[model samples]
Target: MVKLIHTLVDHSDDVNYCAFSSSCLASCSLDKTIRLYSLNNFIELPYSPLKGHTYAVHCCCFSPSGHILASCSTDGTTMLWDTHNGQTLAVLKQPHGSPVRVCRFSPDSTYLVSGAADGSIVLWNVQSLKLYRSGSVKDGSLVACAFSPNGNLFVTGSSCGDLTIWDDKMRCLYNEKAHDLGVTCCDFSSHTVSDGEQGSRYFRMASCGQDNQIKLWLISFVDFLGCELKYECTLNGHTAPVLACAFSYDGQMLVSGSVDKSIIIHDTKTRSILHTLTQHTRYVTTCAFAPDIPLLATGSMDKTVNIWQFDPKQHCTGSLLEDEPKMSVENWSEEEVSVWLCAQGLKDLVGIFKMHNIDGKELLSLTKHSLTNDLKIESLGLRTKVFRKIEELRIKVDSVSLGIPDEFLCPITRELMKEPVIAADGYSYEKEAMENWISKKRRSSPMTNLPLHSLVLIPNRTLKMAINRWLETQQKYNETT
Candidate 1:
């Protein structure tokens, strides 16, 4: 586990962005070409090089499906490539006046969004091969834009300290001047909870800024006349400008990389520092957590990406022996037990199975009949029987159909399988698809290759009004049902 996995060194100059496919890493650099390196530890040089940008390639991203690669460059252009054939499918020319700093594909891989030094944000329809709409922020340069997990909303951070949220249709919903200095990064977290009654959905947003602060906002219900969005809390800690921030997949931890060359992990609830990772020798540029693994990756100006493995068992043991002395099961009161059970996503099991209430009652006698046979009654000596019963229950639960909506399904493969494989048209192409697409496109499109330019203007007020209306409609639907 502590081995050097891979070292991708094809970039002739400073690399700005590095993203992962299922089996490869795609990196963009000031050298203007995006390089794809195999994830295998043995592979050294890039498996393929995509060269098309007339200037430095600022950012490169893989679609959620991993079947498409979208790249933006200092040439003021964006290109879409067919991941399967290494073909340039489309070229977006001069989308902005200045260099495009960053570009990202929508969660569904149906759209592309780019931010530029010209203080403009452009949304493009991938399938239709058309520029949908462009909005001007009228501030400093646009740094980053991220679509929410639900794909229904997105947030853009600006160099002028503004953070704006927009709908999927490219309408600005919430506009706020969030910081005294430029905002560097932001992310959204959604969690499901059963608060004594029934399971409900909740979301929170985290943002970092050049003002040396990390702020958190709970997306809660608001009794308002115009908008239902409201800011909840601001978590301030970093001593230097924060460069990047991301939430764990489980929405329990928040990690922020800062210009101070440190990565800080904060508890999502308490908004308190859990760990301060200080290994990087230079400014930590970016950090991301594996979606399904207990691994954290940090990229730095030190020219290295450090991968940290999180050991939950060791973390629990250390917590139990901390100076403050964490409360154990033996010290739990009635209220604490309820909280623990709820926190484990077992709210329905609360009060139904109490150790104190069990006397001579048969294991299946006191509970709901439907769950009795499903339960595994065990003893210290009945190890074999207990394991068999546990396996049976797991199979039964796995077989149960929860009727999850298609929207909740992963867009990559349109399925609910664990560790989902990225697919397109019923085929699972290897990770090289994105790189192949970029390479093919560059060879075909010469006229579209140009450098980016910059400009500044105000965002459209009409688009903001439209987005506000859409949010209000969704809120009303949720409230009614």
Candidate 2:
């Protein structure tokens, strides 16, 4: 049975997107802001109404660690903010200056990809917020994007009715005409379907569109050189244009919202309707499933977000929180450490770990010297291996601490800008590089390939000051390290 737990009626305009982390829920709206809520009691967080965007906020997503939140807007910029304090971390401007419609973080949270209305896609390195790669589709307002569970591939859907697949390097892997009218939204299932082989795996993806239909696809990552996308089936449960769709954390159920003012839940395995809810009075725009709980959030044009709870037994056989409690490795007990060691193929180390009473805190603090001196490991290879694993764990536990600031590098030289200059194209570049290009009779912007309206270049003193501050901070950090 499905039960409505709470209704959030805070937004004054149409809600565009909604997302859930393990501890918080975020929703963005046409009111030009994003709101945060605590999952404990569905109370609005103090960081609610993040107001950096100049226009309507279209989409928002939480990183894998939930320490960072990304929101894209009609202002042609995607901003990353500290989820805990609502402080702006970085602002990434679209190259074409088109309104960004969607943004998603890779499974590993190493990369952030944003899609613009001009069909442009920019992949940003999350650590430094530098532009990693940029590409454009043939035609369409890029509307939807989702990363595969494995983080090796991502798929984007456009208003031109095309679904295109891309790799980590932003290379086009596959493209297909998915919907006749226009694709509104798409999502990849969280779980992978094994083909009874050690390496072969197939992922199920769902896409809903203006055609009033949802299509299922079987995506194969079996071969990196030649990925495949095969049509599985079509779901026609919604009566009107389906705006949003998402797979549950367990991948056993799929939910979608549509212009029919209703939400539909489907049994993905049986391809049958489990429930149909008509609680919203207007078009339902977005929906999401909590990663750790049996809760579902749906947003609508009625300017409200409804949170629902589903019985775990009715949807799946196992408990929903079975694998979710280990989210905070820092809070793990000594016994949990032993189990983790065995799972990491280091069963031999579990005995030593238990003897030393090594819990999550101890594991995170293990360095090469500690592993050799404290743990009394003489073998160089084994000590290096243990230290490496611990470092990886540290990264997963607190990745936000590793990232710095953004857009401090010149797009032309791909280096830190010494004398920043703003051209007519509205992008900052190294003054020397821009002057050299202008002197060489190049009357176009190096980044945009568009004609330069004038040769006059304006000095960006603000950017120069920001870069200097960052340099000073880095110098101090290096000295301390």
Candidate 3:
């Protein structure tokens, strides 16, 4: 079933990288040029070669949706190209002050991440093709980068032989000394694999290095230690340094390209080689699997690109998540909870939580309390309507599912607060609602009826965060429900 369908030899020099979109193949080369080929006919597109870089183009990546292609070069520039007509969309000059080594698109296709010889990683917004953020992995150059399927995590491999996993906030979640030699390539699965022991489902990550091995990993939640990444297994069949690895759309097959000019396709479950492709005469540097197809693309230093196809369909079977995993709210900080609340547009809930010292984990108990007697919540004037809304949200009506948790609902207007603020008497209310209460209605506390000490409403940042976490949890359950 393994067959080379086409060989594209448009590059005048060594091809550094290659990628497969749904309709096209893109390759960058040491000729300081980028090229596109149509997968339908296996011929170069009418635009042919795109020339702009002053030095060798080191890497190129197609966004998940196949809308944009990103290329980085030794010219110290990264360019975004419109994949349709081969026009430059945007250009970033001297992002790293050295050769841009690699670039990748986030699983969601909303972000583009590029790594360079200067040890810097820059994230670009795909829509605007503008820089979103940038950071350094270490003093050593970043050679490879990947984003988890959930879009919550990413991993970068540095020349110093370390692999660092980071969260959406760019916080290092885990770091591993993966290989004795610099890691040459890394990729994430399109599907998640379950950690049979922890009963956890997580994306599988594979990294190949100068050590001639491919390492597999998964992010798992451990009981006392919180979230952790576990090393799963290793495959070692390549005779020389493995330069690239990619997971099939279904995540059942793992493909590795080596300096020995051989590509090994391993069954991920058995860690056994299923096929060995020796069609390239020089070191194979890059490879990619089309997200929903059987096609695989690989490039070599031999200045050629090969498109290989398998007979069997390689689409994801279904979701790997059987049960929604719980994120620990026991240690969630107040600020974190507040952020969630704000994101959910429920700032009014913060006051009630603070008035009662509510932790996000205590939501079940909070639900047990009815609207009639929940610690003087409804007594507040504007808050009465908010509590009413909470009562309505707790139940699934004839069609609508259970909405946000009752406690997170704003007390002033009986809706999710647009801007939550704390009034003087330690009760949370919508800032606008409170303003109306004091100015239009009366100059007294809605709940206490005491003269207003101060109208200053402190933002309930912690509650906002809790609201966000809660929403995410609910959404996850809804998917698997």
Candidate 4:
């Protein structure tokens, strides 16, 4: 199921976009500050928030190696920041007549691409930190731009739904109408194509727009005539305008978020909706799945970023289970199984069966007598409905789920410190709470009312590790028992 782990609400204005790196997550806002948060500790990094842009930062992207972060803004400029120390690397301001709506880094991190509302696409050289070149269309504003997986080709999508494909040398290779209204988002998959048709399927790109539909474009390589772009298929389900779409690292699943406040995870091979995640209440502005982890990060106009992960045990048997006739119990796709499970409730003994690593079909194959008398299920009702029949054996959550020992509790809030910091008063506390006391409230630490020497909040990594280990142990004990 798509569980909302955290609702980040630091931005004063609308959170325009969210991007992820290996160890950090970056978000830009209309507040005109780009903030970086630590993924490991879930706390805002110190000395963060590169604040040079004059206007609302619209979009941000991290390089392939997670070293550099590039952001664009309404100020008509792009700023490159060092992700390590939160320092501004360079500012490539070309003075385009319109706001730079989108920015992307090449796979190799050698080039940076920016698309502006003025219909211009600028390719900047990363090493030289200068304008490598630029391309423009006659009309319409460019809303999105993406470099091909190979980085040799790039694409620009406009407000008029026009798509222009360009090469590394800034030459237009393909120009055509792609969607109705405007193209809001586009993503490319250059990862090795799955299946035997790898001979011709060199690259594929998925595009979504205000028209409420998604089109997949497949580019095939020819012997001598270069590459050709052909329409592969169109996916339809979203009733409202689709805002953003991203492919997983493996390029096997594509997730799209829409103004309808829902996310649809689709199978890239079958072109079918594997799951529909409806966790966001407002229009989801952007969605990106982690290239390495199973986490999916989504940002909304509601001023929040949610992290979702796919868990295998929670899924109900349906989509992939239908193929259980041909395959054994061990051959299920964990992601697909999770998608089906997120939609339904956990049925009684079914959850136990799943926890015990019992196959879904094997449970369905049992008769009512076998289910009740042998497996100890009183009444399963029917096999089809047993997908959600997982209540009886559900994990017993305690009043305090983490069950952290009293020693780990913060001195002020009484809650376990997610970001524990050792204040100078010889007391440990949540950093934000401690900061509020000493910095904002102009008072000394609660433990020692005497004026403190310093307000520096040194992170307590050892204590945090202890807290995390305790939480993980309790969570695993709950899950298994």
Candidate 5:
């Protein structure tokens, strides 16, 4: 079961949208205000309240960098606010005759998109506060719009269940019936690679609707044939309307929140229900996952936003205990069994990563160090200098040994000592071959070096005490000004 770390109650009205940053969460509500909450202290009042919307705020989103917020309201206006100071930056009045339902910033943060009840979608130049292009869909109101992860394509879903894809030039590329009922929310998956499968270099879109279904589509750009879009798969598990849907960083798991008062995790390839999370007491209106963290946040009409931790161990189970109960007990010593059990327990970690918005892309990657790794400046400063020297030495050594230029090396695989793991020979190693060998040795030996720490069982308490002392010494460091 997932647990909530804290519950924040501030909005007297229904929270229409909730977005998270590294240190804060921004929520807009029908109370005609946007509130910013510091995650570290939820009991404290919001760090600031942004009040400008005259009517109910429909949607609010943080920019990729978390520095700016864009919100749409029923007052037929979209406003941009400075997140740091709670100051309104710009206000854009609707050119059409309807309330703005959705507003989002482009992946590059250079433009903003807003969809309204008047069946119109407008793009604005954020820096200049100038309107870029205004496009109209047929018959129904535009309910949702999302910019593709690559920023080349943008899509809009209508109340009539029609999905339209547009290029940067505002040309309509693909138009199709996406759902039976009104489309409520849409998201695009970023480029990702998992296990061995690589996601599309472009972008894949996920859309949820009142039809009680979530649909995934592949978007492709064609020079000669124009833009070609194809329906990939349909995920069906929700009993009521699916209000929001988002793809995980790895693109293997897709999460959808519904009016059924449940959140469902779906395997994108098989379309199987992996987990059904039932915690929300009311209709879920919005849901989003942290790009770098294994955390998910959802807001519902129940006047609460829930934070969930994604536990990977709930999905993977090993059969070592089932096949050989006696052998498993006899062949492995108590210390070995303890290590195995610890590994199994570690698998249940909340997989969260450090996220950075760079060059308009949300880069999700592992944190630089372990959770227990201290930020002691004395220890860390020396390590940082050593790392720089090592990098310089590595470049010099490579220039002398390998005839290939440094420019030709693949940036993704160039760095050594990237992720340290144990070798079969029981020594720590940084090469990929060492990791492969350790995986094979794990079938017999209970000991393996993890990314965080190296663990071993000692025969004597004295040895354990000595190791603990060494760890304490490493952790004790004074910061030098």
Candidate 6:
């Protein structure tokens, strides 16, 4: 059961796309402006209409943290905005100035990818506001793109009906003719389900095309072995071409909008229609699910956006539960830290940790000097072990608190990249590791598992300098701490 909560008739032209973050809803229009609405009460923000594009805005999405918003336009640029005040942070011009069709942020929000009408896709480093890499499909205009939940991979759909998967480094992993006509939109679900194989997990993806069908796929990745895509099922609920499809936060429900001016919500587990909504009088162009709530937003060519509300428990048992008040590692108490230490097989340190009253924050802040002088740990080996564990914990916590820059790590070694070089596959790698890979006759790319077209390796001076600057920042932070 679904209820039409509101019909926002603000956009003068067709609503091209609509997306939801945790607290905000954004919709871009052919009128060349984007509107922001507070999810709390559906009121238009004070800076509701963000106007900067010289041409029509095609797509818009918010960063994971909802601090930054990205929008692409026929103006041949993807503009980054400070969501707090709607101030333009940066404008990234597309290569060759092609009209940008779609833009999406990686799951981690560290990267933003924009696809253009000329089949070119540019990956941008969000922090530095610089172009990281660029690639083009063999045929058709690139119109749709989505990043996998882990942010390790992304797929782009083109007007040629091809779906191409690429690694984080911009290396093409797989290319397939997904639709007979053209692909309109695609999305990856946030939830993972077991594939019935031990140690193998897969995520579901929904892709709609002009062929009047919505297709489901299972995308699974094996470390360094590349990714595998399997056709799960085909859905033909729409009488006309399906334009947009989105999965619910829990992956229990999938919603789609089509040319027939209808929106259908399907139960992913049962592969059955849950609800059919026909509130819009014209073709529905885009739809999305709210990240934290059971709300759906659909945009239509009738120049209206419909917001729908539903009960998740009615659809699936315990589908979405209110988050319990769980503490992050930094907020863990001394007892919680002791339990974590025991779980990590350091039970011997529990007594010492209890004596020192080390909480999670202090545990991460511990160094070799602190372990020897403060905790009175005599053995250098034990001190080294404790320090190493603390460092590992810090890395994990830092990754969640502040995302670890992926560009600083080598795709092959997963270590901080040193002496970075660009391979023929359009990905950067450590020079020694890449040289060894080539010398060992491993002609395929480690990231893509595709043959290296050329054996050329060019020094990536920019990335090298960026990594050095990041290292210096980290060093200074450590010294200050």
- Which runs in model 1 stand beyond 4 Å of their true positions? 1-12, 40-46, 83-87, 190-201, 220-227, 312-481
Worst 10 residues of 1 by lDDT: 445-454
Estimate TM-scores for all models.
Answer: 0.59, 0.65, 0.63, 0.65, 0.63, 0.66
Encode model 6's per-residue lDDT on 244-325: one tens digit a residue: 9999888888889999888877778756555667779999999999988878999999999999987655644322111211
- Comparing 1 and 2 on lDDT, the stronger one: 2
RMSD after CA superposition, every candidate = 21.3, 22.8, 21.9, 24.2, 19.9, 20.1
> What is candidate 6's local distance difference test score?
0.86
What is the per-residue lDDT of model 4 for residues 215-252, given as tens digits with 9 covering 90 to 100? 88775543336555656567765768999998877787
Predictions in order: lDDT: 0.60, 0.86, 0.74, 0.73, 0.66, 0.86
Candidate 4 CA-lDDT value: 0.73
For candidate 5, the lDDT comes to 0.66
Q: How close is candidate 6 to the true structure, as a TM-score?
A: 0.66
| Model 3 agreement with the true structure over 73-124: per-residue lDDT tens digits | 9888888888778898888764637788888888788777878888888887
Segments in model 5 whose C-alpha atoms lie over 4 Å from true places: 43-47, 192-202, 312-481
Deviation from native of the Cα of residue 115 in model 3, angstroms: 1.0
lDDT-best of 1 and 6: 6
Residue 33 Cα positional deviation in candidate 3, in Å, after optimal superposition: 1.2
* lDDT: the better of candidates 1 and 4: 4
lDDT of 3 at 328: 41
Better of 4 and 5 by TM-score: 4
Model 4 segments more than 4 A misplaced: 194-198, 221-226, 312-481
Model 5 weakest 10-residue run by lDDT: 357-366
